[model samples]
Target: MTRRTVRIAMNGVTGRMGYRQHLVRSILAIREQGGLDLGDGEVVWPEPVLVGRRAHALEELAERHGLTEWSTDLDAVLADDSVEIYFDAQVTSARVEAIKKAIAAGKHVYTEKPTATDVEGALDLARLARDAGIKHGVVQDKIFLPGLRKLKRLIDGGFFGEILSVRGEFGYWVFEGDWQAAQRPSWNYRAEDGGGIVVDMFPHWEYVLHELFGQVTSVTAHVRTHVPQRWDEQGKPYEATADDAAYGIFELAGGAVAQINSSWTVRVNRDELVEFQVDGTHGSAVAGLRNCRVQHRSSTPKPVWNPDLPVTESFRDQWQEIPDNQEFDNGFKAQWELFLRHVVQGAPYTWDLLAGARGVQLAELGLKSSAEGRRFDIPELTL
Candidate 1:
């Protein structure tokens, strides 16, 4: 078998999402599986060099993972010819510049999105990547989610015939850290630090909506900062300038309205931390992060309202569970595999920098709509 090693520079993997999702669950998992099979007696293995600021932490991580290389010298790593891909999972405020540096250094670039804080920066990055003639991609892990995959399958089989509306509820209570420790980092609440629910979550929504349903034609939003202040890592109280919660109404290309609620101040009362309930003429489906349940028009329950009387019908049990017909990998890993295949075999890779820019555009417009107190039309991005 022809085995090829693709050297990659992994940046900011010390962070939670970067470490858990991108590094440990994805690239390392791929390495453990003997790399990616090309189906022609060839395999492409990934060789990653961990790059972060803290040398001691990086050394610890590298030694624990049995990684041979770790570096704080990003410029030196980027200058190396052996490194083919530059992957960034840094704070959003730090991403665009690092990505630009990678592109300029003649490396293929892949990064977490929203690629930039604003629409202009995102688009500019897309244009620069295009001009550099390097392959670029943004993380859209939701599309590869097993639950969403099943929903896509149903949509493909015409199960969701004439889809009417989609309602997505995504969020959980993020403790203020007054008593119990907060689950999320405090940086997530600061606007200057590239934090906010609208910026963080809307990117995922944009890709999910664009890939599964349709393009977002317009958006109306109401945003708020429920907790104005929160304690930081050093136990210092700080002001949170960003919106902690965002309620949005989106008009899709095909006349479907999507209502999405994202917040850190709310408690979840659903089967999953995040769930999307889709309604269509022929059938309806509710998909969580890992499971999907559907109710066909023919098998849908008929229940009459009886608020005064005791409940008789089990409404929750009416939906049929979608079976796992095949083995599914971690969502982030799945997308990484696709991207690797695209890099190695010239496979179809459409989730480019432009797609990422659209996500940032949506977030920007949503914030603008919230500020202006009116709906804003989202014209199709041209780059």
Candidate 2:
């Protein structure tokens, strides 16, 4: 009996998500968990070689992780036969070229979302991976979230007899890299860098909607640039070339409607960083990052709108909390484990390049809708 160890070359290993999500949380941490029990002792441990742009930064990160293999040359790493997988966490603008190079080098790939900034580019990469006969996957971590997973179970169990609509509210005030260091990368504020709330996040909603409810058939969107300028890491001003907020209406395949409001300018008002409310004919469920609550018609409360009346008690007690049944790890980390299993043990992983293309398609359609001031029909992604 032999154990298979997958050697991974991590591109953009020093970036925010690259460091936190892929490296520390996913590969190193999961490896510590003895490679995410895939049954039958067919464990997978990542023999990772960190690839970055700066030798100093790469070496520092390697030392932090007690790893010695770090490189500044991506092409050199790809040319190495021992690198069976090329994982990308590069900026969205850089992902396409890196993934293409990895595919050309005959290595399996796992990459961060938007796979490419545009639908055609994403489709091309998907086709390239298919033509090359290499395994490829994208990160769709939100679907694997524990709270969302439970909500999915409820939906699957008919708790929502017929889902009428889904409302998603996701946002937080991203720091203006000037006065307060921006929580997100500077590129996220630049259009050329593939940064924009709509482009970056709609794919997440698209997949979640498709996976939990149904496929999106059409989209009507309104995008806005709330703050025209934001500061970079050095407290220098940079004109924001991308939109900060987007509101979209999606018509799903089953006639279910979904509304998504994604922004970088809103303040958090709830327990979860991201919250969703699914309303059905029989009941309604509200799910956040930390908790889920349900309200049935039988237990529903009536409400009246009044300007002078106290509003605290109307809907406060209408829903009951769903008990937390499982410990939820970081969403990115969980997806990483799954990808490893999918690669090593052939586990059912549907977040492939095609799925990524679907997300890009929706984003493309959203952009079209926003630009033309008309609803756009989304054609299905043909693998």
| lDDT at 296, model 1 | 98
Clashing residue pair totals per candidate (backbone < 3 A)? 0, 0
Residue 123 in candidate 1 has what lDDT? 95
Pairs with backbone N, CA or C atoms under 3 Å apart (clashes), candidate 2:
none
Count of clashing pairs, candidate 2: 0
Name the 10 consecutive residues with the lowest summed lDDT in model 2. 35-44
- All candidates: TM-score: 0.99, 0.96
lDDT of all predictions: 0.93, 0.89
For 158-252, candidate 2 gives per-residue lDDT tens digits of: 99898999999999999877777889988898998889998889999999999999999999999999999998877889999999999999999
**TM-score attained by model 2:** 0.96
Best by lDDT: 1
| Model 2 ranges off by over 4 Å | 306-308, 312-314
